[model samples]
Target chain A: MEAASVLERRNFNGLLDALTARGYRPIGPVLEAGRIVYGPIQRDSDLPIGKTDIHDGGMYRIADRPDDALFGYNLPSDSWKQYLFPPHSRLWTATKSNGSFTVAAEEIDPPRYALLGVRACELAAIRVQDTVFTGAFPDRQYNAVRDDVLIVGVNCGQAGGTCFCTSMGTGPQLTDGYDLVLTELLDGDHRFLVRSGTATGADILRELPLTPATPADCAEAEALIEHVSGHMGRMLDTDGIKDLLYDNAEHERWDDVATRCLACANCTMVCPTCFCVTTEDRPTLDGATAERWRTWDSCFSLGFSHIHGGPIRTSVKARYRQWMTHKLATWIDQFGTSGCVGCGRCITWCPVGIDITHEVAAIRTEEAVHAHR
Target chain B: MRKPKLAVWKFASCDGCQLSLLDAEDELLAVAGAVEIANFPEASREVLPGPYQLSLVEGSITTPHDAERIQQVRSESEFLVTIGACATAGGIQALRNWADVAEFTRSVYATPEFIDTLDTSTAIADHVTVDFELRGCPINKGQLLEVVNAFLYGRRPDIPGYSVCIECKRRGTTCVMVADGTPCLGPVTQAGCGALCPAYHRGCYGCFGPAESANLPALISELRRLEVDDATLVRALRTYNAYAPEFRAASDELEVTG
Candidate 1:
């Protein structure tokens, strides 16, 4: 396995077969109900080929591309968070008999997964989750699933309308946290410029028929990154953004955003790095046995801050402020990394077009004027 | 240990919520084992007397007699729970809150003089205190079972007050409004149906009613931008959970603007 090899489009299915042989269930994007979602990929046709994505604040859809190009679209509506920290998973089970109780921790047997379309921002997000789940206090379940994951990253050919990965320095080009990386070159021969990030990644590539990549292929991949960076539809200035949000605690801008914010938690639900959850115990009807589960939760929910008397964040304004401030500012202190990866999911999936980049810029602009005047 | 007595009551609804309990075929036997089904007319003909430990009331207060009946039902039960859109937020029939009921009765009834009704249809909570409210067009049977089970075990039911988008994301369903041009009420609507309509490529008609602090104005404005006519917005809001304060106010404003 060389440093840079070309896997022609014809031999793509063999790549999937190689991953299967190594006990990795390949997962990739598939079009469902007019949008792309990650599901099991058994064949090459399962990929969203010849699909061109149209993304904007509060809007996302796919149309036909003039040429057949798999992995043409940006991030799917749902991220890879579902694979790692699943929505609902049992934690433990308890059985009661003769006034005595016996408890058994939920035994986990997660599948070894090979993620096919890991974008740069998504890879950054996975790393952010790594710190949250595997930091000082490790989540046994998440660690078990995360350990078996094989991330096959992809470099972007084009940017979505709401994308700001370049601004956040998380994407358009990946740095690390990938086993294998790919650049789908369009103008040249319909082929992929595949590179290995780890030894295991090289091992899988050995199973496929590969040719050494020419200098032209490497240059084309570089040019593709520059093109995506230049044509990005959105931008966010991260200059003192964390401090700016922290300083403007009572900014009237929050009230304005609240007028439009549904507090539906769409932003958090779609955000790749927003790791928040709640636990519940499901006791059976007869009181003989009980099962416990952990489910995804959001700070935008009123009950997410429930204390003794009532919920802490009651108004939509308070909840919205808490979310943005924590995402850009407080998350750094708590997790040692920014909670947002600039995936643009929070913007595009919002029912109302409430862009975070726009919100941050608005506050920054207001503060700049006040500071000087 | 004797099981607690459970009673089911109906008011101005179609009895769909009561049917949801019967639909829980698997949980129904377990429920019967845990609680003596003293007054579930839908499941049995044996009508037990009053002072029930738990009362599951369905439907809205549309008739004058039913309004008085709900008060009696409340007094006879230790803990009263409202089930379905009608009992919680005055179901689709709450459309009459805006129109002339007398004219409607005259148009539909053969003998209009014989019909007795109130000027406005309202939720059960308007008449008596509701310990809990289960939302849906017809409540989700799983959630209904959870509620019954929770009450039996002396704990609050684990019902979420979040939007349907959470459930949609969990179920791996793409956003219908974002992916397609369909105007959906999922953002303002509460989660309970497991995002049923969105999974099937249909916009949520708000069967579960308004979520906590539902920003109807925001959603309505977004729908308007999607080229949804004002008439459609009004009609969408006035559906299953029509008189839920947030939906009611939103529809009323749209009617004025339309």
Candidate 2:
């Protein structure tokens, strides 16, 4: 068993101060523009302590929670994707001089990040992205920033209306991929059960004024995590999901879902595993200078499938099928795991309320009927 | 080698898409260096002869003379690219396709005889074979530049074919539909505007026109399920790209069903 310690609710600000003192910029949840978004954090006040978000298909809003516990809600709209893979990045710039052009690469020096209030599902999502960006070719820009970031994960005591992480076996309690793990126990004592998962985490733990966690505290944390596991708002049936999707390439359910799917790419944008990008050249007005930039791209777009002949996935049905199948089926073949962490952002963010879980269920139901026949 | 002669032509449009080239403030001088702006009445009073290397035509065919003028423009240019919703999909004026155009002309114009316009507004592709069609109400300046760059480089332009959802996802924008129940047209609409409307906390109005293989029936039914009235659904499809085949078909089908 890993070593555990108790951090009182009042002393939470100390952890932020300690992280800042160590030169790691603390980034956590912030209530901005009526939504909980991730940005710079200095103290415990930055976290949406008493705020919880109400999320449903095509519906999301911030509401006051009954208690004042940090990380008392589900995933925020923006994930840590921005910190790892930014929206826009200039790759190289070329300046024309005397009929010749000289190209220079942009300097890449990422800041040391201490990600606070990270949920288990998000950690899993990060790992999924890690496999993508650090694969055979390796994205240098992503690695430059991702290699130094420290993960501070928070175990979910309760699941959100859109949360299906338990079903995906990626959440409620993080067993790996985090430097430090925290389980907030608001029962008798307003304290947190903190456990160091890495040497760096252990070093940070030594600096904090923490007490040795008793067995009762550990048991309390265990019970809460177990309870959250069984009480998820949504569940995905992953039994042979890869095979099921592969088998149902021509499934009518895809056509049904595609009709409702706006092909808006909202799900992919909110999705933590998606990694498609397209590069464009921006030349200066004087034609003297030019720069190339890589922006996030999606399979839902027609240009994503465009070739010299024409676009392969010209229809909404085809594009939506490509997105869902890639995330659930082909991802396993490519990365040894499902692209989805079951964070349920895609389902909640879909403009038309087209639920991925529901789509899978529809296909599974059809497959069962076919099997019976 | 001499620079390729480039020209910009306008019809019945707001000239917003043509202005997009002008809006390429930083890249204008660079692009100008690569191509000679022979005839651009919007930016310059100078008129160059036809037989141009590349021509960027904006607006829809709303008049008989403009229709004839397009044929001449097509004959003169080696490559013709239609820019924006007006050129690629008949534009917002194509809303007249659903109603009586004579009634519209009579109601608006003091002397209806002076107004010589076609009953239907049609995309440039409907009249002539366009080399490429760049979608958007006011085409994205970046994409417009990409098109020009591709032309100069003798390569295919890299424009997005996916829905607005993809762009929104790239930007990490919150889904307004899920977050606020805003009935966005992003899923069915072609992407290029960088999911602009969603970032501003409003649903997309399909300013970029319909995406490839847009499923109008499915989107319409889903919107209806969301309590969007039949009339509103029809109106939604009849927006910027009202004359676009996919939107036109959907709107027309709904008009009959309602």
Candidate 3:
């Protein structure tokens, strides 16, 4: 199939029709309970079109946008993890009768999904999770769903105040890891600069009505990506960051963050790439059968590291430290990438407004002073 | 010979910790083969009368009934293993220790007088002798498996007792506190979680509890110089394992001055 592109009103309904006709379960952003959240899109009308979200530490509110664009904001409270790694999933079942026991394995069947308007930073977060779930032992459940996903990456035209994707080296532009990349170009008529990175994506583009890339469209897309990249409100110096955090374990900065941090695990929960999980069991009404299930877990929870006698991270200070260190420093060793994609979700959803970028900069400055001494 | 019988018990908690055992999807079948699940009410409706070989208890003794029930559980089980921060420490509910119980009871429930509860929620160890205790707000399943396996094999479980710093080093995870000046509890926390928090670019809140021979005086001195106030330090220590001896002692020493 030859690669092609199609132009619609650049509104929600047009994108929905394009996604549905392709036999994909369209998932997009919608306003729910005064906040933007990712959920199933029945049609274009379901999306939060012409809507922008106001976000800061401990706050998120939706505001009306003048332009009726499908992808208008950085991110909402929900991340891609909600669909990929669900909050709870049954793993297996067990049954026993008359001293004889048998086990029943639960089958994992992920729906064929079309992720619409995925921001560049979120794409980076998805890649980080791909490495964690698929790179190592290969989580059978995660792989089952992730394999059939059709990702539609969108270039960020506007950066959120909390956004730091530029520093994470994973955003502002869709470089790779997508079926189709779209750059929204509003030139009198709303249009998109669509490019295909995979054969499947090319096939989809072939089916859609699209014009060959004009030099002006290409130039606009490039300029938009670069402009958005530079407009990032936050930055983190990854250079020697792992060593800086690891070597100064007793630094005084942790106490500062711990004071405000509720240790609510909301940051980890909302984080697109945080994949820590724990499990539970439920027995059938008959009491003859039992099923075990897996659920999302957070390091911030005192129970996450509970051992034989007590919790390892007994204090709020310890839990906070463990979370930051693992995300930035240890993540490099575990996944060969920083756990944080600098999506800014942690900062926005955090009830106390603890900004990760500010925390990293503080550490950097402290290290610099120590170096001089 | 019949396989050893295993039982799971819960007390005062969110039931999240006991759920960790059931979360071991890959090893669930293998685990079932090794033991007879005798009394896990959360997982099985069939309550096999115990003289259980092993009992995995979650949550803490927060009520009079729970305090008495723990003794019964200890009497019925050969091996009693407490799981999660609630079972090993007092858990978040232990925050009640710092406030007036009557006021708290009135705020949450309508008939505070009818609710029979203890002034302070305490770990199982305070009521009965525990064979072992798993640390964490929710204990890690991998370590849980090791402990169960060790009991089955009649040997001591090879669980690490050093600080989380060692696990971070062994896993080649950089120290967030050292490198980024992020405050971390890896230096004082017991290693079991494989240094999960540090790997995720966050400071340790000591969910795994205190390590053996933890130098709290030094940690406090550094924190103080770092401008950590006594109230903040006290609140930090009195989290999941607020009742655990080492943590409890440290937090007690940092009581708020009027």
Candidate 4:
């Protein structure tokens, strides 16, 4: 909500202090297990400063960059989903009292999280989950956690090998859905061109020591985003992909991919928008008390489609078809946008290096060839 | 209502799966209260005759004696659930099925005549029909609890048969195969271990066995395209769930094709 300002890298620590001052716990990317992952951070030293990453199909490594920029890396493997919609959540607990039963739901209030160095694609992913959680039913648990998150988005200066946000029309630059967007300017004096998108962000920015941005500073930030947008390593021609995938129900490529798929739900897991869940009930030894739980689930699982009869999607080919179709096709029909944000997390995370972009292109190419024939 | 009788039996295993039942710790107290833990040698010396409401069978039938024992256990129990890689598949020991047992017996034992084995370490499902099979190397604690809870509630257990990829997704773990070119079996392996290996930045070892309807030929071909050698491919299949039919056939095919 404040005019774009320039904050030197030295004074960046003040920003973290300001967020923490407001009772917000700051979480950002930190070097962990040879890769950058989201974790609680108090100091700038906790960030993967002066580090970048190399990511290809079935390959990832962290490398030293020329300058020390706090957010100088591609997206981390784990998304913000875990923080918002945790892997495991206790829903309610019940106990037998006399002849009646008493049930109590788990408290929904979660800590206010100030998420630092979020990328455009990841922001898009958060929005996707937002729509899902705040749907007709409006999941109270997800809403309670999501409402308290403060998004500090970082515009990507460079693309990773698996990145394709350009094709997905999602990123490389922050458009909206962020409290503040940051563009690191390593060209001259190391500084960030900060722009606030919300009133809370403006209040936070006013607290940090900041200088009004010069015309050159704004131009530099734009140039960096333009450079990133142009150099996306992977691309998906999603012009008619929804129809393309839905029509090719019996495509030979389905059988080909099914063989390599492994049905490991890794793609959906890394995806920013996949929101399937299953419930389990745990009882006390006396069977007098029980606690119902909710955890993340994947469509690739046979039990995910299980009914009284059997699983609806019985074959690997059928299961693969269901996931792809839902992500690219039916998701649009249901949610009005593509399930994928083009972050390329699925492509980079797949054990077999099965690229969704590659799979989609193969189908589109065959469709074109068939049309010509 | 009378408390349901719960029984646990073993054959050939590290007792890891049975240990998981005890490892329930906090939940074990509740489970013990809900059901009469009739016969669990790993946990208690107290033994009870069967006609059990639910029986949790661990390990595989390696000896001629165990082959007969599983049948008696099945007859006594109304619902038989096989837990872990050993009982669901053949487990790691099932690798013996590919080699000559006679040579292994002669080499390991001082007196080969004292040993009693059926040459193949087979699953409980091979001899008797199982109501359900919980697949994993040591088995996930949450899932094992679900199986017990489902049986007590008279409903089908909601264990997933999808690959470990789903677990990786839920945990938000990056894909080890795509990120590091690590040869992983997560794609085809079942989804009970919560994608454990991948979370630690390693490829899945197929501990939960091949997921339902796993496309073994296709996954193997992808590994081959990555220039994974024939022996490595064979070794991959012959690990935790080596004797699982899907992986066993794939490994045998690669051996023959070579």
Best by TM-score: 1
Considering chain A alone, what is the TM-score of candidate 2?
0.97
Task: Tell me, by DockQ, which candidate is best.
Answer: 1
Weakest lDDT window of 10 consecutive positions for candidate 4 chain A: A280-289
Judging by lDDT against the true structure, name the best candidate. Answer: 1
lDDT of 1 by residue, B1-258 (tens): 888899999998999899999998878788889999999888889999989999999999999899889989999999899999999998888889889999999999999999999878899999899999999998999899999989989998999999998899888888888889799999888999999998999999899999987998888888888999998888888888889999888888888888
Model 4 regions more than 4 Å off: A98-100, B42-46, B198-202, B222-228
Give the per-residue lDDT digits (tens) of candidate 3, residues A1-373. Answer: 2233535553435555666787889887776645567778897678777888766554556778888776777786678888888777889999978987688778876888999888888998988899988885898888888999999888888888778888888888888888888887765577887878888877767666666777777788788888888887777888888998898778888987776665556577778888987776554323467778886667865667878997788777788889899999999988899999988888875544678878878988987898899
lDDT by residue for model 2 (A1-373), tens = 4789999999998888888888999898898767888889987888888888987777788899888988888888888998899878999999999989999998899899999888989999999999988988898899999999999999987888888997788987889878888999989988999998899888888888899999999999999998988888788999999999999999999878765776666777788888888787866544668899988777876677777897888777888888989999999999999999988888777766678899999999998999999
Displacement of residue B111 (Cα, Å) in model 3 is 22
User: Where's the lowest-lDDT run of ten residues in candidate 3 chain B?
Assistant: B170-179
| Overall local distance difference test of candidate 3 | 0.78
DockQ-based class of model 1: medium
* Regions of candidate 2 where Cα sits further than 4 Å from its true position: A91-106, A246-252, A280-292, A306-322
Each prediction's whole-model lDDT (CA): 0.90, 0.86, 0.78, 0.86
Whole-model lDDT, candidate 2? 0.86
Model 3 is docked with a DockQ of: 0.04
By summed lDDT, the worst window of 10 consecutive residues in model 3 chain A runs over: A1-10
